[model samples]
Target: MRGEFAHLGDLPEKQVCHECIGEKYLSGQIEVEGIPATCDYCAEIETPCLSIVEIAGRVQTAIEQHYSMTPDGPDDYQSAWLRDKESDYNWEREGEPVQGVVAELLCAADCIAADILELLSDRFDCRRPGDPDEGETEFAHTSFYELKAHSHRDWDRKWQRLEVALKNEVRFFNQEVLDVLKSVFNNLHQMQFRTLDVAVVQVGPSTALEALYRAREFQSSLDLKKALESPVGELGPPPGKYARAGRMNASGISVFYGSEQAHSALSEIRPVVGSNVVVAKFSIIRPLHLLDLRALKTISFKGSLFDPSYAEEKQRIGFLSTLTDRLTVPVMPGEQEREYLTTQAVADYLAGMSEPELDGILFPSVQDGKGVNVVLFHKAALVEPLAKTGRKVVSASIEDIDYEFDVRHPEYEINTETIEELGGSVPMLPLFFDFDAHLESLRQPEHREPSLRLELESIEVHDIKAVVLQTTVLPVRVTPQRQHRAGHTESGEPKF
Candidate 1:
């Protein structure tokens, strides 16, 4: 009610305050209610906006294109979220349909994205524009809603009993999403659904950033490119898109009320949440990409980093190269495959390297003058949380929760590496690329390698003594005290 207001004609057309507009929007200065604050562009588009109902209809169509239920169908790899038929499920919203649309589109895939804002409900409320009847204007508080799924595993046993595994270990992926949701949850104490558990699989921003690079490389590969260009029967989705399930870039999550109910409901569904066609794609494709060292060596950024417009991809590729060059990573041994270091292999190796090992490489600090040494890549993981039987099963459906941050402070960039080099490992954990074992390794005394360990048992001799020989070399663990710089942890405590 007390904020600035002007008619469309009064505002200058050529003079633009785009930055000012963004600041106002982020700071909650713009709202539906109070005095009518008219801008030239907003007023022009206001009358032409489509109604919310029409927008929902478009969303329905897009959803149909993206998610298919038939086991053998094109979207079979797509995670089952909204039920098979449109009538089976209902769209739930409150406060404002515009807010709902905004929330939904935050993670929605390509098709319905362009027309999102036009669908805002006419009834959508913004605080009254001008001075209110009350003493002051009421600003709308931005709220964040997070969906999390956890799985329980029996670490002592190698997943023998589903019951035991469900009881002991909670598994979840989509590390990038959780990190953001948790950070927001921490900062915005007023957020709804505060009672939900906050169990984050500990991964430093750096490791997560490296993993994202690999995800991007996976997405950019020639094989994936060819798959998108040519119609492939095995993969789903419209042309020029890979199957969503194996999508290194996105994921889906389904929150269930209970185990019996979840199973009963999901049984009608084809595969378990994690074992779907999408997961299978990653299983089949990731290793092959890893072994295909040529793919790794051939990775190149599509644009130039020095130019601000094209800086994103270039910055990422440059950082990846800098990190790869810094680390003394060993060749990743391939099974019936060559053991060598390609650019991508180096990325994979560095991704699995523990914080201490990374520190060793980056210690004595070399500065490339890159904006940030670490960057982030996020996948949409599907999360399914069941309530009925309440088995501690952890299910993740990766969804595209587009949240990101940079460790811009020089101190964080300097300290972690410097500390590790001085015979100390930072607390940062190694991000295990193996999805199943990712969270588990975080809870370990030392992070595991990209490959599993193999042991040789001794051969028995009938009458003579026999000896056991060590055939293969195992990975070493990096250990030291955990250090934090400003902007790194939830506490926002800088321990430089």
Candidate 2:
């Protein structure tokens, strides 16, 4: 083994001890294979260590596995690769001194660092050091080893393919598109399981206690009062037949859309001035498994650089960081039917998944940048009936109930005085008017369990006086040019 590293000729036989190494994993490796010897860099007596030659060889192998040599200069036809005003391309490199690399992996001493660099010179390339005139060493300053992390090219191509397939090639029953989505989301699901806290959020009355606000614009006060009377039925997710296509759901597919902020919900409905907007707060009843897309923006994966799938995992993470924006990008009016297909498919697929089943998605609100929005799947979108009773209804039943609205405070006051008498003497009790049980009795076999409970007191009616618009203004410059005649130059020469 000594003869194999002849390039390390005349270097001290003293071992580079594990105590001198900075990288934990590399130091651990050295500790396992080391024998008791004097350390060359730290001058430690009888320390666990490996020789300079051995350490350099290990580093060379690891670098070969994780890095690639960058091109020295731009090709003849590829001028774009060259940096502006430079003869050689300003390629990305480990922009650190030879000593720096050694310090990062080993000790930051000149003698041992120079020895390691000399031994690996044939296997590595580096940037020329600063001029001696500028008080700098003649040795190389930076290593030309590029880390082999995956790039956006692969993920971008796959996304484009899927987008095209969904919008143009095959909108429905496309196995290829489905398979691609499955691969992406399955990886995401696995990542969520690995990082439970950041990816999956628990929303319920006892857990995070998330209060979601939903708003509807009404043409008249009459319609607003009707919605106020039955907030669960009117303000919750609409029936399937009345459902319209949205960012996360296709037409006829009912889903819950709510915002963390009341203003955000009101803005989403786009109510005009002088229009009536009814806003209601809904509480999460049972525990919900919501995938937090906002968290995905900052989510990361930790793995060994030497792992074979490390680069791929990095790519997947990079893609996920940008996925929230892709899913929530606002589509222009009339173009939503086509633009929403990809996100709609994603929501549908996530809803159908059984393993690590997701009830909904929590994403950044597009209408209100500072707020967040939630879209619960049809299965988890059912709003619990406002009225309920623990006791079973026997024979007593409510004939009628008077509903009064407080215009000043914007609250609904249900009057039970109009309740009819069951047997002239025995008045119909309020306990017999169990809305939940009645709804359950009338529920179809396929009806899903309710997940949200509307807080009747949280209802609000807003008269839109003004709307503040947040926008970015781009200047349009009109440059005047001398108009050239058809097939003629600016100087009016013969057309060529």
Candidate 3:
């Protein structure tokens, strides 16, 4: 009844997905063991739910087309309904579901997103197309739609950018340009369309939302059409009272996601409207079996680990110093210190760092220390640890190298103390050696027996939003040596 599926008739007033139930289990909110990989019960229910989503998409499309074709439909009362399920888009391919579990859920959630948009339109006095130069007559709401695959990482990055732009009150259009455009639009269109009505609607993990928020000069629909029709590259900024008010009219964003992590991240960003954008699932609207099945599949995949506190005084100073040097911010003449360090500026700069830069800040390189210098030789590279101290990470290294003691050989002697001018002990270690062999030895239970150790570390995407890890050098018998090609050694042999 709600979305065109008869099975959706038994919709519960409130329902939670299997993954959420699983999350409860993982978080100790519900204590249960032996959780299965795929919940057969939930899958069966969700399959039918996908049909409702497809139907909703068709219905929404139909409505939009009707409006576009007949701009003036004041007397027209049009509604859409799915005739049959068999003719609807197939939710299965090769006997398997065409979409992922989350995707299927999102597919249904799209209908809910549309409904929310509709509600918003009525509240905002959404102005449909009237005058030629005014605004969109077909669609009353000023919103951009972004559809994408489900990627929590991408969503997090977008939220970070949006937060930065919003907090700084970044201005997109020149006031004069906006005024002229607004006047032109007002005279052309019979209706008034304000920028404040516009909003960024994100369906999945979208890159377009970032562009919309970050663009300094945005052209209206008419401006865009004119630019395409003409040869001029400069169309200028969008015109509206909201356009000149510093921040773009899009004071809010509506994000849709199937995962709990995505919802949690979106909830953190406060918007002028619809910040907590959880989608209504058609699966829940299905029969009573659907509710039971929903209870079966929801599993929590959230993992945890110790993260470094970035707000510590030491870190703050280091971050500011590094940011200044890296970005090349200008200092007042004759003044070695920075004159201004606004919170917004710092946040914006921090947000601009690429993944690698952000990673460096969170888990910086480590210096030589007392504990086992655990040089994680992952895959085929010597993975560097954090430079600063006081953090620990328990991730399973790709490979572990061992330095076995051979008492019969002088190089195995632990008592040998060869001091260097740098005030460090130069132990009797191999000058030139095979990294693979060394790593294998470390893995070996005995000096001669080498093997690979598979250790799964608990690392989750949500848990590591920004983590500063502690480190101690893992003790391996092999001395650090430069990587070499096959059959190459400069030293004859190592001595104790």
* Superposed model 2: Cα runs more than 4 Å off: 1-58, 61-94, 99-119, 122-150, 186-197, 389-447, 484-496
- Give TM-scores for every candidate, taking all chains together and pairing residue i with residue i: 0.16, 0.68, 0.16
Q: Which residue segments of model 3 deviate by more than 4 Å?
A: 1-108, 126-133, 137-142, 145-496
Per residue, candidate 3 scores C-alpha lDDT tens digits across 52-146 of: 23323433443342212223212222212233444543221121111222223233343343443443233334445683455333334443222
Q: What is the C-alpha RMSD of each candidate to the true structure, in Å?
A: 31.1, 8.7, 31.9
Error of 1 at 220 (Å): 50
Best by TM-score: 2
lDDT tens digits by residue: candidate 1, 252-366: 2110110111122122222322232111111111110111111222234432111233333333333322323323233232411221212222333333333212210111111
Off by over 4 Å in 1: 1-19, 22-88, 93-337, 343-496
Tell me how candidate 3 scores on lDDT.
Answer: 0.25
Higher-lDDT candidate among 2 and 3? Answer: 2
Better-scoring candidate (TM-score), 1 or 3: 1
Error of 2 at 231 (Å): 2.1
User: How much does candidate 2 score in TM-score?
Assistant: 0.68
